[model samples]
Target: MTTTRMPRSGSLPAVRRAALVLLAGAGVALSPLPAQAAAGGGGPSSAAVAAAPAAAAASSAAQTVVSTALAQKGKPYVWAGAGPNSYDCSGLTQRAFAAAGVKLPHSSRMQSKMGAPVSRNALRPGDLVFFYNPVSHVGIYIGNGQMVHAPRAGDVVKVSSFDRMPGFHSARRLA
Candidate 1:
């Protein structure tokens, strides 16, 4: 089997990098990791992260998912790539959420049935927003009515407004 990797780009600051390792080693499970970023800035990692409200952690998780998704913008869309360089619609969403400690199915139709149903007017960041009948496609909601998705076989990962996604099916909040 082939594996995908992302060469560390040094895009994240040194402290955040250290935080990633330290927290990952501590088995902190990257759930809403703004706590790690906060801790990296010098406060006690455990206390700072632990004291954070549940909502803060969840919000951080959502942000983490969005950032992870956006990082792949311009990556080619592959039919079944679940990757560091290329991805399919559901593959992109699965990878992003997994980075935030959420597991997802690879099939868009399966994913649509996994998370709690959310209304169009109530969509929030990190929600799995699906499109097309039979739910052939999916994307990660990034607020302001925008989503990051792998549109198709020839397209790259990109951010698009709601109008760009036809067959606006239901949204599901997984994080």
Candidate 2:
């Protein structure tokens, strides 16, 4: 009688990288292990290695949205505005979210009413922060404790650190 063994999926290298990327973000740092070091003679399978790039691309895209919004700092503010000319507080946020492929309502009050509430400390790059007694103002939280918004009707869009803004009520993550 001849004896034969089936290769287990666990033995594949590609499966390992895919699992790692899924477990962590694209930022997962991996040290190259020699093929001989692995249980199988072959290094991690091609699939795992291929998965890394996709995860990295996703993370990079997310970062780009925040950066793009920040880059628009100093642009003029136009009431009831959106896009290349100028922006109101909500218009700035709407444009920023649109850049990241998320759509939001035109009014700050409308926007403040959407999305899950996030704590100030837990805020992420694309989150929206609301302000004022009646929630008349809104800004896009760009991570690192700062946000981008149109300060007033006469002012231009700008980036303000969290401490610089007054009366922050809550943050909402849109993307």
How large is the C-alpha RMSD of every model relative to the true structure? 12.5, 17.8
Local distance difference test, each candidate = 0.68, 0.59
Q: Per-residue lDDT of 1-175 in model 1, one digit per residue for the tens?
A: 2122222637455544554444445433343222211111111123432343212123655777777777777788999989877889999888887775555678999888865689999877778888878789899887766777888888788777765678988798755
Q: Which regions of candidate 2 are displaced past 4 Å?
A: 1-62
Clash totals for all models, in order? 1, 4
RMSD of 2: 17.8
Runs of candidate 1 with Cα error greater than 4 angstroms are 1-58
Ten contiguous residues minimizing lDDT sum, candidate 1 = 35-44
- TM-score, prediction 1: 0.67
TM-score of each model, in listed order: 0.67, 0.63
State the lDDT at 37 in candidate 1. 13
Give the Å shift of residue 47 in candidate 2: 46
lDDT of 1 at 83: 85
